[model samples]
Target chain A: MKPEYDLLVVGGGPGGALAARTAAEQGLSVCLVEKRPAIGVPVRCAEGVGRDLLTEFMDPDPAWISAEVERAVLVAPDGYRITLEPSMAGCEVGYVLDRKRFDRDLVMQAANAGADIQVKTRAVAPIVKNGAVAGALLEQQGSVSEVLARVVVAADGVESKFARWAGLETAVPLSEIETCVQFLMTGIEIDPGATVFYLGNEVAPEGYVWIFPKGDRTANVGIGISGKKCRSGSRPIDYLNRFIKSSFPEGRVLEWVMGGVPVCRPLERTVADGLIVVGDAARVSDPITGGGIYNAMFTGRLAGKIAAEAIGRGDVSADGLMPYDAGWRSSKLGMALERNYRVKEYFITLSDEKLNRLVHSVSQIDLAQFSVLGIITELVRQDPSLLLELRAIRKLL
Target chain B: MLLIRRDICGYCGCCVSVCPQGALELIDAYLSVGEDCTGCGICARACPLGALEVADEA
Candidate 1:
């Protein structure tokens, strides 16, 4: 069967939902499809977001927040710690969200905006006509159907087939992908005010381990290992379980989430003829930190706004949507993402010993007086030799 | 046509970072070559962005 709509958004995650809502608000008839049975089921995120990053798009609804974070603790491999005060940390200083509520809330907003949400509907392929993407073919409840629209927004996550199917070559290499495993645990005494980050190859190997407090007693303890490193045989979960046993031995496990993050740079082109890809699908997450929600939401808003304007003008080609890409590249989200990608590459190349030493060096500095970016830039400034070391190290990449 | 995704490129300086001949350097959050890229495509693949592409050099 063929269903027609003004805008057909594939994948009802944050990006898709927001796109649908924004498009609908612009008076476009919209339909959002998701493969999952519900909006937020089978949570894939680390369940953390910065308060400042979130404020630009929408207000923090009390229903979506799980905890309020006030500080950050940067831990070295040898257990040295540098605490970050909220004011210096910039945005994201105050949130450990309940992603279930967070994801549901975005979709709820879309639904309230008059978009048709289709759960358990998987977008199998892009519908094309005259060599241009027109919409998508969806598999709903074991039956296949076609949905047609003037524009298609591909918001499918890291394993985004739609983006590839739509003709944009968005492939994340193994080295750039961080395989992550998280456990929601209780019985661990953690300060709700602070989120802890542990950096060292011995612990995570090219990535790091994070402890994001959901409540005073419960936390999402997780570890991320580079996929290239994992090819040698150590798994993310194995490392995470080992860390838990050694660090929070008394903590009780409540839930688990295994996922991958694209920590590489962003895609060169996010737009194709008659189609736009957003969020993880477009590699919109932060490379250094692996954070995507803020960037994803920001990109989604731009895509939605651009798509609405294009549809209204009846111009839905690649040329018509170039503004979305240009606008995003100039935004603060884009600037930070690009800078972080460079820093992440520098970080992953550090040897275990260098990492430990760097962490030790950082732990001694007063983080409250400097931004994370400022601290790293200072580290590079303090040791001109380290720049040479980094240059020498680049020979391996 | 060689296409590079800008967002996924990790400026690890590896493409230019690890070039034995000093062919690459980071310029404004991206790795660029100094008229001697060698068309090796090493930087292209070494790039987490998959941003670098060795095309016709045209």
Candidate 2:
């Protein structure tokens, strides 16, 4: 779209689009590019977000929201259900979105803010000068061109090739990566106001099965297991197929999709000289639940704000961008990721029997003033050994 | 060699991120293998669609 700009954003997901919009609103030139011909077409996510989290980026528009979740039901291996009411609202009890319109809406907002937007444009390589990323070589419609900028925002989703090209080690290990598959199923009986999760090693193996209802009779039925657990006869799709047969035999499959989610720590360094990485590319998805829409928008906005400040000061070095890194790491989102990663690692080690016992114990009680400490107290009363195990992990925090 | 059945592949970028060798690329819904590939089969194992395979070059 332009020979050069103050900032060039690679990828047009929530993160990239918000970055471009925020930067452009700050009076910096911006261009956002997406490799896909259309935005959010293949809909890889479960499309669930918290009510407050969605509001942080943009007001929840009914045009994009498919469902408003009011509660969550955690199904144990033995079919014991633990229902978390609205008081436990911090989790995914919020909105199931139609990401097709949601992603496009963010890009449109960026365009309205004076940022140039281009789809079907892939950033093939980073244009490095003096060992700092200056811009990228973008290819579109079988033609290639260079777009140079003072700062480059890498929001290229899970592939993250742009960050890799800029010399960042963006590869995720099999153990940390979650191999996922989901089917949009209709004609399935589902509670229109509740999101359900089935947990246990037998169910997902280091992950869980999610049923996010889109309407009265349609839902996103999905499973995400650790990549290390994936195999020929028991891959993610295999698991999903089995679960569908058992749970929703009469359901009609409307669509099917598969992808990977990085359920690991964010990159050690999210910013380099003249470059900032955001969203799944930075591995900012929630380590326990694999949710990322909020994290992406948060980091994208922060990156834009910080990059604008850096440009104003005429400094785009890693040191200049270090505040962006430090800013997010110290934010509430960063703290939660660090905390949940440990919890995820511990949960995967729990046997199905143990999970059932724990779920049964928790379901027997009513959490009046739900809090982490209260939950820990409740858990310790049920299983004393958990206290020592939690202590071992808590010391690290 | 790493064989990619483009038909079976969903091109979700799963293999590209899991390759220990950083040898696979998902180019606009197409999987591209770079020379850096050692045929370690990590991507094959990580692919949810079972679209990738490590085999003899011949």
Candidate 3:
């Protein structure tokens, strides 16, 4: 007989794991399906996350963090640098994490909360009954089965098909996708506690290069370029290689990873009858930075709470899940994401000259006490003409 | 051999930036490999456009 669950989460990434944990904590029966044979295998991230963001819902364990970050180095195309020091950076702390361990920890937390986790289980399609999602057809280890649930949360990553299957308009235009590639390297000369961001069209075009230190003279160095600008027939690896050879001439790469970052605004809606989507699955990543962990977990918590409430009310419909939207939007994560999206679009459309000019302007700011958003707002304030561009970008936010 | 489809390349230069062997170069807005091309396939994977095609060099 097929197992029944009050909630079935499709994907055991950060978002799904958190959703499962949240729902189970609320006393709802939850089952999580992970397509990967083991959670967090073939790790695909720069693994840089804010300490404070993760702590809001769950405390950080030493096993998951590689290093404590204290500074951020912003470099322009011409090699001009701006340093954001630690004293004024507040608890907006940063950490380079062991992602595999981090993901496993989340799954462990969910399992401890009583959610059933099945590995190597893929959700093939939503099982629709009477015009609503009843459950999903799952393929496990080459065998197929079905599981029924009252509520389903799609926490799949950036390339989520579940949203489209659930009839949500989840397509991200190429212009809004950032092609990223990272190399884990050793023997590099860099500050072990500072994260570096390289900006300029010459180096990364519409995207940027990042050097996130992983500790002990190693770092995850990578670049992400806007897919629309990538139409010029240059791949991200080509750009990364050139940068590494020139910048870190003595660095030796130990591993390589290539992936996509979604820079689009959050989806118009994240809920449907018997369904909720969180994290990258719902385009909940930072539109400007392409970071998803914090937002993913935040949305996951909202989805989990709403799912539990719906199950408790015996009403797992679209309207029942509306609270998830309201709750998440009211949270700091949502506001930051919305503002970041506006900031991202503004920077994405800038030409090389404009980028250099913007960087030059930014270098004059005392970022120690200012958030990136505040800096942008100040820039707009200085040049009132930028208000027009800000207004156009604000619509998407 | 990896063939990069010109239409999809983002020209973000990520491939050029991460290549370990210095095999790729940006010329006329397209990524071209020199004789030292290692066929590492990293370039293809790094291509967000899915523009790079990696096949065994015949």
Candidate 4:
């Protein structure tokens, strides 16, 4: 007899693992599945997280942190550099994770929490029964089996089909999706405590290039470009190759990663009958930064807790899962996403001249009392009409 | 009317999801462009790596 699970979480990333662990901790029987033989292989992220936010959720494990960033460097098209020293209270990032270890540790936590983990097991499709998701048909090692669950949590990343399979509108417009490529390069002389960003259309064509240092001599050098802005038949790899040739000619590429990020507003509906989508599957990433780990964990934690409660009450319908959606959107994480998306949409269309001007203006701002309002004020000083537009954004946010 | 940069395609299946006509499929890690494609350019536009394009073959 196939063992029935009260909660089944798919993907095994931070969101899925955390959700499974959270539910199991609440005394719910949970099963977590990962298609990969191990988690976090062939890492696709640049892997930087705000220190304060990371610590707020869980204790920072020594094994997971590769480097601690203290400064941020932004270079404009003309090679004008703007250095920022983010205060402890601000949204400055502090850690660049060793992604492999970080992801494995999360899965380990889930396993320790008593969730049945099945690595190398793929969830082929949701088994809908009686008009709601009953379980999923899973395939592993040439064998197929059914794992029934009262609720299914889809924590799959941006490329997930589970949400759509469960009858949700998960389509992302071209303009809102970022095609990304990353190379873990070694032998580069870079500050391990500084995160670098190169911004310009010529640099990434509607996106930016980043170098998040993992250690003194190695970093994750990457580019993320808007899908629609790409020229006909040109790959991000072409741009990345050119950037590498110019910037880090001596850097040795250790690994190559290719993926897409959906940088849009959270889906209007993350919950359907007996199913809830969290993380990138729900487009919970920050549109401006394309960072989803924090939001994923936030939504996952809440979804697991809420799902456990719903199952306890014997109501696992869409209505029962609505509270998870409401709780996540009402938190600070939701507020940041809402505001960032507005800012990103407003600024993404800026021309090269305007972008250079903006970068130049940002360089001139004093960091002694850095704040969003102060930066906006400085930007308005450079381009007076921006004051009015920014005011509109403020109102919307 | 569809141009695929076969060498550049990363086989991410992002295009498969955006194809309105269901003309794209990832078979064994390879992109299989079907005859049902209408040259709507949605797949080309949605491909993150810019691996697809619409050619003026008409």
TM-score of each: 0.83, 0.97, 0.85, 0.91
Candidate 3 — what's its lDDT?
A: 0.79
Worst 10 residues of 4 chain B by lDDT: B20-29
DockQ of 3: 0.09
Q: Residues A166-230, candidate 2, lDDT per residue (tens digit)?
A: 88888899899999999999999999899999998888998999999999899999999999999
Per-residue lDDT of B55 in model 3? 79
Error of 4 at A368 (Å): 5.5
Instruction: Supply the DockQ value of model 2.
Output: 0.83
- Tens-place lDDT digits, model 3, residues A1-397: 2478999998888999999999999999999988767897657688989887788877788998998898888787777787777766442578988888999999999999999999878787899988788899988867788899999999877656676777887656656778887899999998998999999887997889999999988999998987656643466777888899899999999887766777877889888999998998788888877788888888898899999988888888888888998778778788878877777767877776656666667656665646766566566767788777778654443
Off by over 4 Å in 4: A86-91, A366-374, B1-13, B16-41, B48-58
- In order of lDDT, best first, we have 2, 4, 3, 1
Compute the lDDT for candidate 4: 0.82
At residue B8, candidate 3 shows an lDDT of: 68
Better candidate by TM-score, 3 or 4? 4
The global C-alpha lDDT for each of the candidates, from Candidate 1 onward, is: 0.76, 0.89, 0.79, 0.82
> Candidate 4 DockQ score?
0.38
lDDT (Cα, tens digit) per residue for candidate 1, span A28-138: 999998876788866767878888778877999888888888888888777778777765535247688888888888998998999889888888779999877998989
Pairs in steric clash, model 2: none
Each prediction's DockQ against the real complex: 0.03, 0.83, 0.09, 0.38
After superposing candidate 1, which stretches have Cα over 4 Å from the reference?
A: A87-92, A363-369, A389-397, B1-58
Q: Candidate 4 residues B1-58, lDDT tens each?
A: 8888988787666676566565665532467777989999987876756678889886
